[model samples]
Target: MITRHLTDISSKGFKVHEISGAVDTLHNHNRRDYYKIVLVTGDMILTYGDQTIEINGTILFFANPRVPHTVVHRSKEKKGYACLFTEAFIAGRERAEILQSSPLFRTDANPVIPVNSEQAAFLGSLYREMLSVHRSDYDYRNQLLRSCVELIIHEALKIQPSPNGLQQKNAATRITHLFMELLERQFPVESTGDPLRLRTAQDFAGALSVHVNYLNRAVKGFTGKPTSVHIAERIAAEAKALLQHSNWSIADIAYGLGFEYPTYFNNYFKRVTGATPKSFRKRKV
Candidate 1:
């Protein structure tokens, strides 16, 4: 497929494009702030998460911000339309969270829907309308395009409507820095009075304003370990440093590290270090 024309997603939050030019190799993760829908005919290989999928013929595709994906063109003869939009594009919906759990955009779900000729024609016509609406001067163009986007999304799933940040070199790198900064902010475990405010992957993810899974992908992609592992290791390292360098009691250490009880801390430290905290501390003493 050949392609041309892309509406600026950065400024307006959404745009519909006619699939009229050579299908460019697309890595969806780079555009980490948006979601995408495509209805196209082509022979292509799609790299979604860690899976590689190759498809020939007509198919509809959905991509969300949480997963990293790439589409490679395998054949020249392709036709289709693609819609791109930011999450803000749908912010006005009452329960936008519904879209967050849609199987179509889930990391585990196959994002492809085989389009029969009739379905293709119908979806294609919607795309055409969207492209026009996207380029129009109508005051309600965005609203209309949003409705069209919702329509295509539902058209693909045959379902009803639902309600569904930072700067760095790239998304993963930026996310990694954010994750690390957030991870370190609760450090030193200086006092049990202020336990770690954020401890789990979910905690950090919530603090960073992203899905835990998305944060994991970015952290693991760049750091070669899951977010939880990073958090665990950081805590473990802190535990060791405290045991060796600080005069704090084991119970105090435990509480400072966010453990409610010394026994829990002992179990955790032993599991991570294969040595009980008391034993390690004695040896250090």
Candidate 2:
């Protein structure tokens, strides 16, 4: 499936939808551009990264944009609400950092937690409030919605930690974390002329002040993929986003993505996606 980005949500930067009717149609095993929190109450299976989890009761789950995951509903009836919002929706807020660093949203941390009846009631009420505010005519609805989002996050923080516990941090894990963060920070390319600053594994290693081979080994050891592969995948993802969402010409997109020539970008894109950039854009259209 094509990864869903912030633009796929409302221009207001947030959306809340009931989960039961939509679970079957929701995108599966794809990366998304926004944060997701869902309150599920039924039998379901979730696959996050490399782990698979089964839930049979009330639960609250968080998914970050950087982590790829999917959900499978086993029962015919499900009850819950899911809200999605972009980082920009919460930017400059006091709790933005808390939201970003919370274990519930961390890629390496367990994202699902079982909730008792009272906790489920409280969380469900918050979702209901958010849905109500979303449909209201208030001028400050976005602010109200953000507050509800923060409340949901804070509540999840108080629940029991993921059963998988915390991941032990080692040199390889640390380096890989830094590399992935640095790579993600360059994403969602904002303008046609705004080229990606770091385009290669060597560039990332240089930025991290580590030797190229050391960085590669660390990344590969932790993620089971070469550093170059990660870099190329991220670049390809951004290239697809730009080609689909921006008015920029192919040459401009190439330059913006740090390609010296449009032909190089074309070949690279075809190599990575099995389609030329123009064809990809056409197919998307």
Among these predicted structures, which one has the highest lDDT? 2
lDDT tens string, model 1, 124-171? 888889888877899998888877776676676563223223322254
lDDT, candidate 2, 57-171, per-residue tens: 9998888666567878787778898888876776556875766556444454567879999999999999999889888899999889988888887887778553431343444
Q: Rate the local accuracy (lDDT) of all candidates.
A: 0.74, 0.78
TM-score of each: 0.58, 0.61
Q: How high is the lDDT of residue 68 in model 2?
A: 69
- Candidate 2: minimum summed lDDT over ten consecutive residues — where? 162-171
Candidate 2 residue spans exceeding 4 A from truth: 1-8, 21-31, 103-105, 162-166, 169-285
- State which candidate has the highest TM-score: 2
**Residue 96 error, candidate 1, Å:** 1.7
